[model samples]
Target: MSKLTMPYQCLKQCGNLLIAARGSTIETFNLESRSLVSSWKCPSSKPLVSETSAQEEVTAVESPAPAEAAPEESVIPPVKRRKLSLSETPAEENKNWKHNNKGKNHRQAAASTGLDSPAVIALAVTSNGHHVIAVTSEDKSIRVFENSYINLKHELKQLSQRTMPKRPCGLAITDDSSTIISADKFGDVFSLPLVFQETPIPSKNETPVPATTEADSVLFTPAANHLTVHSVRNRKALENQKRQAKPKPDSSGPEFEHKLLLGHVSMLTDVALHTYNGRHYIFTADRDEHIRISRGIPQAHIIEQFCLGHTDFVSRLCIPSTRPEILISGGGDDELLVWDWENGNLLSRADLKGHVEVVCHEHGKAATDGSVDGLKIAVNQIEWIMVGGEDLVVVGYEAVPALFVFQLTAANTLQHIQRIQLAGNVLSFIVNSEGVVVSVDTVHALFSSSEQRNMAEAVDVQPLSTFVFEDQRLVPGPAFEGAEQRHEVPAEELGRLGALLYGLENLRKREGDGRDED
Candidate 1:
C-alpha cells in the first residue's frame, strides 16, 4: 500500500511511454531503444481472490510463485537489457532482416484468459523504462504504474487518479518527459501535461507535436486538428515554436497556437519517423486512400507528395526497415502496395487476396481492445512494424486481428513463411529489440502475435452439418427444405453429393462406435 501510494503523487507529471491492448494482450517496449520491458497477460478464466493478506502473502513467499497465485495477471517483467535506441548499433536488426527469416514463427494462448473487457485503450512508459501508463476501455482514464523491485518477476504500482475523454485512442509519451498526447475516434486528440485536466486544444485542424525532448520526440498525427507542444523542462527552441498570441476560449473550447492540418480528409492511419541523411521525416496515411509525407521539420513544412494506387481505402501502411525509402500499403481492396516515399513512386506491389472478401479493414480500423464497438473489428489496424530479428514483424487483424511474421527476399517481395494465430483479432502491435508487443481484440481467445501460422492448423473447423460442393453443385442439407432450386447446381449432382455426405457422416459415426467398443 505504501509503495502504491507514493508513486501516485508524482507519476502523473512524469513522461513515461505505454503499450496497451484492446483486450487480447498489452506490453511495454521502449521505442527509443527497441526492446520489450513488460507484459499484461489476461487469465484463462475469472478467479476468486482471498482478501486476507495471509493468503496473498503465502503466494509471494514461495520462491517461484505459482502461476495461479499471480497477484495481478498484468505483470511487468524486468527488462534485462537497456532499451535499444534507434540510432544505436543496428548490427543485430540488420543481420536478421538481411536473412530471409529471423525468429522462428510461434504462437501461444495467454496463460490466463477470460472475457475481453476493461480493454486497454492506451499505453505509455517512461524514458528509463521504470514507469507505465495504461487507459482502460470501461472508464477511459489513464493509470500510472512503476517498477519498484529489480529482483521480482513482476512489478506494477498503479498511480491513476483521474479519467479523460471516452474512447481516446492514440497516446504518446513526449521526450520532454511531461506531456502525453491521445486521439479519439472522432479524429480529435488531447495534450495533457501530467495530471492536468485535458486542455482541449480544438479539433478543427491537425494535431501538433505531442512532446519535447533532446533526443527522439513523438507528436500527434499531423493529419488532424490542433497541435500542442508541452514539456516539463523549460526550453528555448520550442518556446520560439509557440504562438505569441494569447489563448482565447471559443464558443465550444479553447484555442491553440498551432492550427490543425486540414489537408488529410481520411482517418489518419499511422505515424512514423524516417531518419534519412541525418534528418527526420514524418509520414501519414488516411482513409481518403492517400499517403502523405511531411517536410523534415519539428513543426513540419509543406505537404509533400501523395502516394496513390489503391482502388479503395488504404488500410495499412509501413516503411520496411530493410528498404528505408520504400513504403508498404494494404487497402480495402485486399492488395498490398509498395512505394518510394521520396518521390511517391510505385516500386513493387502484391495482392493479398487469399482470405474471404467480406473481411474489411484488414489494415485500418480505428478501435481499441475489449470495448463494444472496438471489438467489432473485421480487420486490424496497422499498429506496429518491427524488423523481426530477420523478417518484418507485421501485427494486424484478419476476420479477427492477428500478428504475422514474414521475410522479404532480394526480389523485394514478401515471402509467405509462417503465420501466427491470436485469440482475438490483432488491433495494433509494437516492436523493439526486447520483444514484440501487440494489442488485440481479447473477447475470444488470446494468442501471441509471434505464433507460427500452420495453415494446416488454421482450423478448417468442420461444421456440425457438412455441405460438400462437387462439380460446382451444392448438395443441400436436410436443414433447408425445398432448397434444391436450380440456380446453378443440378438436382442429380446435389443428390449424389448428399449421398456422399451420408456416406461420410456414417463413416464418422462408425469410427466413433469402434473407438467406444475398443
Candidate 2:
C-alpha cells in the first residue's frame, strides 16, 4: 500500500515525479524513491485593503449610498439589486495589474473565484510533461504552472490563469500545449490560450482618448447631408451591402480571455482531445449518457458524431496511448464499453457483473443487489496503461472495491488477466510505465474499525495502495504481502467399517432365529 498523510485531491504523474494535491497543498514525490521531493501550498489571497487604506474601506462600507425611493406612480417597489459579483469588483482600479479582477476581495470573491482555499480538484499534465494545469475547487478557474518536478525549491511558477464562468468538471490540455479545454458543470466547454504576448506600448507623443464626453453634449449627431442624399433605391442597395460586410459576432467576447468551444444540453462530465489520422478530435462525455466527437479547434461547435450505447451518466473516458482510435468509457452502468470512436462502432463490451466475487471478512461474501445505490458491481474508475510493451486497461469497481487488469487482445477485445482486492474503496488512481498507484478510501467503516481497536500501539498506516503485475498476478508493495488461502478437509478412517457392518447383520439374523425356536 502507498503511504499518504492526507486524502489526495488529485494526482498526476509527470515524467518520474508524482504530483498530488492534498487540500490546499500540492506535493511532488520522486516516483523511483517513493519519497517527498517538494511541497507547495496555495497562497492565501487577501483583499487589496492595506493598513494604509483600511479606514477608507471601512468608511465606504459603513456609510453606504441611501436607497432611492421608487416613483409614486409605480405600484410595486423595484426589486432590490444584488451585490456586485467578484468579477465586477476591480483589483487596483487605477493600476494595470497582470492578474484579473475576479480575485479582488478574497473573502467575498472566494465563494465564486475559490481564491481562499484554492484546493485543486482536477489536474492535467502536458504531453511533454513540462507544464501542468489544475482546476481549483469552487473557483471555476484553471491555473497553469511550470512543471518543476525535479526541483525541491522553486517548484512551480504560475504561468497563466483563466477564470471560468462555471465550476469546471473536467480539464484537458492539448497535445501541442497551445490550448486548454475545460468542461464545466453548466454544460459548456471553453478554450483558453496558453501562450501570451506582451501588451504593446503606446507612442509617447500620442494623447490618450477621453472615455466620455461632457454630460450635456449630444451623443448621436445626424449623418452629413451628402451621405443622406442618396435615392431610396440606391440607399436600399447600400444598406444591404453594409449588412453583408458586417461579420457575425463570435462566441469569443471581450468579457473573457477564453472562448466557448461548444455546449451541451446536459452537464458535461469529462473531455478528451486526441489526434487521429492527422486530424484532431475532441470527445466529450456528459451526464445524459451522451459522448460527442467534434473538431478540436477552429469552429469546434461542429459535431462529428456520437457514441450512444451507454444507458447511464458517463463519468469517465480513456483512450489508450497505444490505441488512440479506441475509446473506453464507464459510468453508472455495471459494465464498461470499449468503442472504435472514430467509426462510431462498439468494438467490445466488458461486463464485470458475475466475474467478480468479493471476499468480505466480516460477512464471508458480499451480497449482490440490482438497485443503483445497492449495486454490488459498478465501474467507478478506468485508466489506460502501457506496461511492459503491452497495452492494458486498469479498472476499479465499488462492489469489492478491488482493482482488475485487462489486456487488450489482438482482436481489439479485453481479456481479464489479474485482480487485486483492496482493503478500502478505490477513489482514484494514477498508472504509469512503472506501476499503478491507487488512492483508496481508507477511512471506511470496516477499515477504520481495525484502527479503532489497535490505536494504543503505534503502527504505520497507509491510505493508498500500490500494486505491480508480475507473471499475471498482482503483487503488493514491499510494505505488505497478500494473504494465503487455506482450506481444511474433514478426516476419515476406512479400515474395518465394512467388516463391522457384516458382523452386526449376522447378529441380527441369529437373534431372529432364536426367537422363532422359542
Candidate 3:
C-alpha cells in the first residue's frame, strides 16, 4: 500500500540554522553543513503534576488527625418548613434535573478530547537565536524552547508552554523580542510576554469568601411575579428565568499576563511588524480585504491608516526590510498590490492571474485555448530578498507548483522577473544566505481537472527543494542533504495531512452565485 508523507507547513531561518515544522515535530538543520541538527516534537497531552504538590497532599493525608474536641451542649436547631409549590412537584423536578444533567455531560465531553495530539501551526525564532517559539493547534498553546548548543551539538529544550484563549492563526515577535503578538481567527489580537511566569498561589492564611451569602440570593429573585406578568410568552419566559437561576460555574479566561493589542471585525490572516523612522508599526491583513497599520505595542490601539485596494480576502502581508515604505499584499485577488503603507497609498498592482494561468497550461491542468474561468488564486507567502545589490520579491501561491519572482522598482512598483517551476505545490519557504529552501507536497497536483494526471508520474517530486540566484535569475541549487526525510503514515491519512497544507483557499467566502471560488 502507498504511504502518506507529512509535509513541512512552517519554515524559518535564524543565522546558520534552518527550522521546519512537519506535523507536530520541529526539525532544525545546519544550513552550511546540510545536516539535521535536532528534532523536537510537541509534548504529551497529559498534564504535568508538580512533585511539591504531590508531597504536600501525601503529608496532609499521612499526618495524625486533630484530637476530637469535647461536644458542646447538643442543641437541635428547629426545622424550617415551607409549602410545596406547583413547579416544585417531584415529577417536574426530576425532568428538569435530567435535562440539566444531559447538558452538563455534553459540555464536559466537548471540553476534553482525551489524547488527541497537537500539530504545530506557526513557528518563529528570536533574532538572537537563543529561543524558538511554536504554536500548536489542538491545545491552542504557545510553546517556547531554548535553542542551545551543548555537548558539541545543537539541541532544543522546552522552556515553557502557555495555552492561549483562542487558536492563534498568525504570530509576530517584537523587534526587541520582548513580547509576542498573536492574532486569532476570532478577530482579536493579543500581546503576551515572551517568557512565561507562573502565577503565585494565594496563601492559606488569607480569608476565604463564603460560598453562599445573603446578597447572592437577591440575584435569583425574579423582578416580576405571576401578578404582574399575564401573557403566555411572558409566563414562559418567567419559567425559563426560574429554571436558569441556578448559579453558574466560574469560567475564567487565561491566567497568564496578556494585553489586547487590537481587533478586527473579520478574521485576521497575517501580521507583520515594521520599523520606520525609529517608530514601529504593525501591519495586519484580514479576510475582509483590509490592510490596517497600527502603532506597535503600548499604542497598538491607535490606528494609523489602511491600505485599501484588495477586492478579495488578503491572506499575506510583506514589508521588505530593504524598502520599509513599501508594503506588498496578496490573497484571493488576481494581482499583487504594492502600497506605500506609511501614506496609505496604492502604488501599483502586478498581474498574478496571468502567471497562474501560464503555470496551469504548462502542467496540463487547463485548456490550451486560454479559456480558463472560475479559477481562484491565493498567495500564500511573500518574501523579500536582495541578490547582487538588487531588490527582489518572491511570491508563492496556494497549490501552485511554481515560485514567482518580481523586481521591486525604485518607484515602488513590481515588474515581473521570472518563475521557478517546482515539481509539487509549495507549502512554505524561507530565504537564507545560502539560498531559498522550500517545503512542498510532492504527492498532490497543482490543480484538479479531468485531464490532470498523477503528479508523481508526470514530474520528479521531493518534499524539500532549493534554489539560488545566478546573474539575477533563480536556478535550482544543490538538494538539501538530510532535509527531505518525512514521517510516513497510512495512505488513509492523506486527506488529513493535505488539509493542513492546503487550507488558504478555505478563506474565500461562498455567496451561492453558482460560481466556484476555489
Q: What are the models' TM-scores?
A: 0.44, 0.65, 0.75
Which parts of model 2 have CA positions greater than 4 angstroms off? 1-5, 45-116, 149-154, 196-256, 355-365, 368-373, 376-378, 398-400, 446-460, 478-518
lDDT of each: 0.42, 0.62, 0.78
Model 2 whole-model lDDT (C-alpha atoms): 0.62
Per-residue lDDT over 1-518 for candidate 2, one digit per residue giving the tens place of the 0 to 100 score:
32223345367888877777655667776676676666667766546655547655655666565588657896763444335444434656423432644334332222232224566768888878888788775555678888653544438667756666677868888878778888886688888877544344468998765344454233333233338657888766655554432232466533546788899977677898988988888899976788999997985989988999987778778898788888999876757889989778888888765445433433344435422234334455688876667788888654244678888877888888777776655556788665787765432323221121122221233544677667545688642121011111111211111121111111111222321100
lDDT of 3 by residue, 174-290 (tens): 878778888988778999888886655567997755467555554555788999999999999888887644465686988788899999988889998888998988889998899
Instruction: Work out how many backbone clashes candidate 1 has.
Output: 46
Model 2 alpha-carbon miss at residue 158, Å: 1.7
TM-score of 2: 0.65
Q: After superposition, how far is residue 445 of candidate 1 from its true place, in Å?
A: 9.2
**Any idea what lDDT model 1 has?**
0.42
Per-residue alpha-carbon lDDT of candidate 1 for residues 1-518, written as tens digits (9 for 90 to 100): 10100000001112233343323235433333333455554333223544466445554554444467556756755424334432233767734542644342211111111222344544666555666666654445566566555674444656433465334444555544465555443343455554333364557686765444533233322322223434544344455434233332345332222223223443454444566666656566555566777654445546667787766555456666656777777655555666777887887665454422222234333234312332321233332233333545343444343444445556666654434443343444444433343333222222322332232332321111112223322232222111111112222222112111111112111212311100
Highest lDDT scorer:
3
lDDT-wise, the better of 1 and 3 is: 3
Alpha carbon deviation, residue 483, candidate 3 (Å) = 3.0
Clashing pairs in 2: none
